[model samples]
Target: MKYPALLPFSELVNQLDQFDSIIDVRSPAEFALDHIPGAINCPVLNDLERIRVGTMYKQVNAFEAKKVGAALVAKNIALHIEEQFLQYPREWKPLIYCWRGGNRSGSMALILAKIGWPVVQLDGGYKAYRQHINTELSQLIGQFQYRVVCGTTGSGKSRLLQALHTQGAQVLDLEKLAEHRGSVLGDLPSTAQPSQKAFESAIWLTLRKFDSSKVVYIESESKKVGNLRVPDHLISCMRNSACISLQLPINLRVALLMQDYAYFISQPNELMKRLHYLTPLHGKEKIRHWQNLSEQDLLHDLVQELIEVHYDPSYLRSIERNFPQLGGMPTIHLNGIAELDFLQLAERLLAE
Candidate 1:
C-alpha cells in the first residue's frame, strides 16, 4: 500500500499475489538452484560479476569491493529498468528479493520507489523463503490423506496417476516433478532433472495447493527418483499411507514397457550403455547377454527379461520392506493397456 515496504517471509507468502511482479536479484547460479516459485530473475550482480566482487572483497578491502560492486549494480539496474520496467505505469507494484535482504534488492526497490511505483522488499529474501519451505514441507505432508499406488515394474502406476488427475483427483506425480521415471533407465532423453532444492520447491508448491480433506493419489517411489531424493518426511508418509495395488497381465506389462521405452529400440547403443550399470548386480555375463539382446533388436525379449530379472525382483523387495500394508491392500487388475481401461479403473477408485 505504501511507496516502499519491507515484508518478512511470513507476510510475503500470503501477499504474493498482490504484486504485479516478483523479482529475484540473486546471481543466476543461485536462482537456478532454487527461488520462489513464480519469481523472475533480474540479477543485479550476475554470475561473473558476483564472483569478481567476492574476490575483491576477500583479497582487497571492503571499501574497494563496495565501490566496484556499487558501479556494477548501478549499471545492471539501469539496463534492467530501461529494458524491462520502462513501460510500467504508476500503479505497477513489484516485490523484490536477493540472497539476503542486502544491497542488491534494496538498490532496486529504492530505484523503483523513487520512480513513484509502489514496491515491496522481501525482508530476509530468498534464504528466508528457503527456510519457510523446509519448515512448511514437514508440517504440510501430514495434513493430506495420501493414496499410494503400488505395482510391479511396467504395471502402469504412473499412467494410473495421470488418469486419476484427469478425473480431477489430487495427484502428486513425483516422477514428473523429478523429470525421471524412477528406474535404472529413467533418465529422460529430452530434458535434465531439476536440482534437489528445485525438486523440493516443486513438491512444496504442489502440496500447498491440495485440499487436506481430499485423497491425494501418488505413486509408490523409493527414497530416490533418479538422482533426486524425495524428502524424508514425505517419503515416510507415503509409505505409511493407504495403498492401491495395480496389477496388469505380464503380456500387457511387456507391451507397455516396450511402448514406453521405444527410444531404446532405435538407439540400441545407448540402451546397451545403460544396461552396463546392472553388471555389478546381475554380473558382467548376464548384463552382456541383455546388451547383446538389445544389439540384435530383440527388444521385447530384452524388456521382458529385464523386468523379470532386474526390476520386478528389486521392486518387490523394496515394496515389501518399505510398505508393510501391501499384503491385504485392494488390488485393481487391468486386462489391457487401452486409455479407456485406465479411465474406468480411475473412476472405480474414485467412486470408492
Candidate 2:
C-alpha cells in the first residue's frame, strides 16, 4: 500500500493540531543539533547504525547497504509500535519527518497507513522547516518594535528583562536563549551553548510568538553571544532601534555581579581560569593581580576592578561603534538592585 500523503511543512505548521504528535525519524545526533519544535525523536537508525550503514553504502553498494539497513529498520519499527504507539487509538494521527522527505519517514508512514491508522510525512521534511524558519525570522524581526536595554556589564539589565517578562511586557531574552551572558567569560560553568542553527531555531520560536504592534524589550548584545552569532538582520535592526540606557552605581553593579557570579566564589580555580582569557588584553601583571584577588577571596575588589578596567571601557566602545541611536537616549538611573527596585523599574519602563 502507498504511504500516507505528503503534507508540506508550511501546511503542517498552520494545521499543527490536526496531528496528535510530530515524530522526527533522524538519527539522535541530528535531532540533538536541532529538530522541529515539539517533535519527539523516533529514530529509524541510531547514530552508530547510521554511520555503519553509510560506510557500507560507500564501500559496497546501495543494494548491499539496504539489505543490512532494512533488517535494522524493521526491528526498530516493531519496537516503536509495541513500546510507543500501542497506546494510541485507531483515530490517532501523527506527522512524521526525516531529512529531506526521505525514506525513513516514508517507511514509518507507510507502515502506519498499512495498519489502517492515518499518518502523513512532511514534504521536504526538516530541511523545509529550517528554510521556512530562515525566511520567516527575517520577516518577523522586521514586524516588531524593539526597545534596547543598554548598560555596561552587571547593570542588572538581564534581571530587569526578567522583571519585565514577569510583568507581562514583551521581552526577547537573548542571553537566556543563547545560554551565555555575551562576554569573554560569558560561558556558564559546566554548560554548553546550543549550536548556531539551534540558537536560530530558538530565536525563531520566540520571535513568532510576539505580537508585531507591541514593543519588544531586548538587551543590547554584541553580534556574537559566546559561540552563537546573532543573525545579521537582527543585529542591524537592534542597533537601529531606540534605546533606554540603564545607569547604576558601581557598588550596586558589583553587588549584582557578586550575586550573579556567586558560583565562582566557591570555585576560585575556575574563576581564575576564566580570567586567564584576559591575559593578552590586560597583560600578565593585571591578570596576576586579578587571579590573586580571586585566590585571596577578595571577590568584591576583583569584580570592581574588572568592571572599571574591562567591561566599562568595552561597553562604551561597543555602544558608540554599533548602536549610534544610543547617543542621546533617555537614561534610567537605578538606585538599588533590590527586588522591589527591579519590579518598579520594569513598571516604569513599560509605562514609558
* Top model number, lDDT: 1
lDDT of 2 by residue, 1-352 (tens): 2459787888777777667989999999999999987789999999999999999999999999998989888888889999999999988988999999478888888898889788888999899999999888899888888989999998989999999999999899999999998887777978899989889998988888788889999999998999899989889889999998999999999999989888888788888889999998999999999998888888899999999999999899989999887878898899999988999989887887
Question: lDDT per prediction?
Answer: 0.91, 0.89
Residue runs of model 1 more than 4 Å from their true location after superposition:
none
Report the error of model 1 at residue 167, Å: 0.9
Model 2 poorest ten-residue lDDT run: 1-10
Per-candidate TM equals 0.97, 0.96
Local distance difference test, candidate 2: 0.89
Note the residue pairs that clash in candidate 1: none
Q: lDDT tens digits, residues 77-157, model 1?
A: 999999999999998999999988568999999998999989999988898898999889889998998999999989999
Which regions in candidate 2 have their CA more than 4 angstroms from the true location?
1-3
Q: What is the lDDT of residue 99 in candidate 2?
A: 91
Error of 1 at 262 (Å): 2.2
